[model samples]
Target: MPTIRLKTTINAPQERVFNLSRSLDLHIASAAKTKEKVISVKQTGLLELNEEVTWRAKHLGVYQNLTSKITQFNFPHSFTDEMQKGAFKSFSHQHLFEKISEEKTQLIDVFEYESPMGILGKLADKLFLKSYMKRFLLERNQVIKTTAESENYKKYIST
Candidate 1:
């Protein structure tokens, strides 16, 4: 398994950042480059614990569908989403928010995943998969940072 961890400091409230991170609309916007779209969802807006969402997207010239469930959630603090069905053998993404100040927040992402196909998967991870996934995550975090720092976040979450 490969784990990627990232911390992004944003000039926004922890609550705002947390909500934006889990917003369905915000996710769609962040992944626009991949043409990602929701195939099904248990609920719209900010995801809560036990909620599941299915997404279809194009990655590395291939189209794929992935379903993940929010297994753990703590309001404005942290949340964990685990893959239920996806290309990966298994995966868990944890989103953590820390309040730096009333107007500043630190957003952290911890992604751990095991690839399929055993040894072949290990080879893929070493070749390009790990870097590709890291880039993907960095882009997503940039979107969240940009949105949270500006008034655009209001479009996704209620203040």
Candidate 2:
């Protein structure tokens, strides 16, 4: 498995950042370039513990569907979501938020994923997927960071 870790500092409250990170609407909006959308569920709001969402998107010129469930949740601090079904062998993402000050928060993303094939998978991960996945997470986190720092986050989370 390859893990991609990212840290983002946002000028916002921990609770606000945490909620925006889990917002279904925000995630879809962030991935607008990929045309990603939730396919299995119509519910579009903040996600909670044990909640599952199935998303369909175009990546690498192919359409893929991935379903993931929130396995662990510690409100305003951290949350973990694991893949239930997807292209990869397995995948999990952990979102953590630390309050740096009254108006600043440090957001951390820990993403771990494994491809299906044996040696081929390893090669793909080493040669291509690693950087691709990292970029994807970085883009997503950038959305979260920007939203958290702006008034747009108000639509995602209530203060």
Candidate 3:
């Protein structure tokens, strides 16, 4: 398994950042470049514990569908989502939020995944998969940071 960690500092409340991170609408908007869309969802709005969402998107010129469930959640703090069905052998993402100040917050992402095909997967990760995934995450984080720092967050989050 390969793990990718990313930290983003946002000029916003920790609670707001946390909510935006889990917002379905925000996620779809951020992934517009990949043409990502929701195929199905257990519930809408911000994802809660045990909620599952299926997303269809084009990656590497192939359209794929991935279903993931929120396995752990701590309000305004942290959450973990694991893949139920996807291209990867296993996938898990942890979202953590730390309050830096009344108006500042730190958002952290810990993504761990194992590609299929064993040795082939290892080779793929070393060759390009890791960097590609990192770039994807970076783009998503940038959108989250921008949204959390502005009034535009109101479009995705209610509270």
The segments of candidate 2 whose C-alpha lies over 4 angstroms from its true place after superposition are none
Model 2 agreement with the true structure over 5-106: per-residue lDDT tens digits: 899999988999999999999999899988999997655998999999999999888999999999999998999999999999999999999999989999
Model 2, residue 42: C-alpha shift (Å): 4.0
TM-score of 3: 0.98
With a 3 Å backbone cut-off (N, CA, C), the pairs that clash in candidate 1 are none
Clashing pairs in 3: none
lDDT (Cα) of model 3: 0.94
lDDT of 3 at 24: 93
Sorted by lDDT (best first), the order is 1, 3, 2
Candidate 3, residue 85: lDDT: 99
Give all TM-scores, in the order shown: 0.98, 0.97, 0.98
User: Weakest 10 consecutive residues, lDDT, candidate 2?
Assistant: 39-48
The window of 10 residues in a row where model 1 has the poorest summed lDDT is 39-48
Q: Point out where model 1 deviates above 4 Å.
A: none
Candidate lDDT (C-alpha), each? 0.94, 0.91, 0.94
